[model samples]
Target: QQQQQQQQQAAAGGDGGQMTEFSIALPAACAQYIVGTNMVNIPTLSKFGAALTLLRDNISGDVVFSYKGSPSAVAESRTLLMHGMNMFGVEIRRQQALLQEQLQA
Candidate 1:
């Protein structure tokens, strides 16, 4: 019965195969900052047929981001997220330099 059910699903689903899940944990503050600044581009993930889920750990003050879709889609989503984070880091450095210059002046 199990084998039969698997066969049926494969037949119904075609060559697309199964969906994959990807997840990452980030500091809560960092997650909020990026999301607030629209750095992560959530809609783009949806466009790729990937669903995004967010969970916060109150005690640890961490946030978990989960994405589910085709393996390639999830991988691409992760890559985009990392790129956004890199941009965020650059912005932070820029802000700090501006602050230092202001204090000097």
Candidate 2:
């Protein structure tokens, strides 16, 4: 009977368990846009995708110019904003790449 119990315990992998799930809250601004109150999906998204989504949602609203501006001026401002967004996208990509490399190591 003791031998049989030992065999059973061995087959059961010695009681080591599965990983646990974790959850975190979203920031106020992001929570407002998120469909659900839960933020479990944030960690699952690719860094670049998350950054792009953030940029898209942020700039979706009207772009307010302080004073009366020419068409060219408004276009210039928009272009600058887009350039900054592109930089953010690049940074996110780099961060993801570094994370992947670390995981492999």
Candidate 3:
């Protein structure tokens, strides 16, 4: 009976991986911009069996990004998300500088 119960639990995912979560808080301005972007559709996340959620944190008036999955998956997703955000920021800054130069010209 014990062995059968264990098997049943395993089959039902009750004894599966330890679900892990990672959360990041972003400034409201950046968070609003991210909300309109396609950053959530990361293909690598599905490959790692991870999911991401974004919400406005009312108390802090910030944006909260939550990643849930196995520990390793969550870590990898965090790394990817941060890298993407950094690259996007750099590009946006470069474009703004270029536009400013054009305007001054």
What's the distance in Å from true for residue 44, model 2? 36
CA-only RMSD, every prediction: 7.7, 22.2, 7.7
Candidate 1, 1-56: lDDT as tens digits = 97776677667883236788777777766665656565445664444222223422
Specify the highest-TM-score model's number: 1
Top-scoring candidate (lDDT): 1
How would you order the candidates by lDDT, starting with the best?
Answer: 1, 3, 2
Model 2 quality (TM-score): 0.37
Better of 1 and 3 by TM-score: 1
For model 3, the stretches where C-alpha displacement exceeds 4 angstroms are 1-16, 43-61
Per-residue lDDT over 52-77 for candidate 2, one digit per residue giving the tens place of the 0 to 100 score: 35544664433222212334444443
What are the clashing pairs of model 2? none
Candidate 3 yields a Cα-based lDDT of: 0.61
C-alpha TM-score for every candidate: 0.59, 0.37, 0.51
Worst 10 residues of 2 by lDDT: 15-24
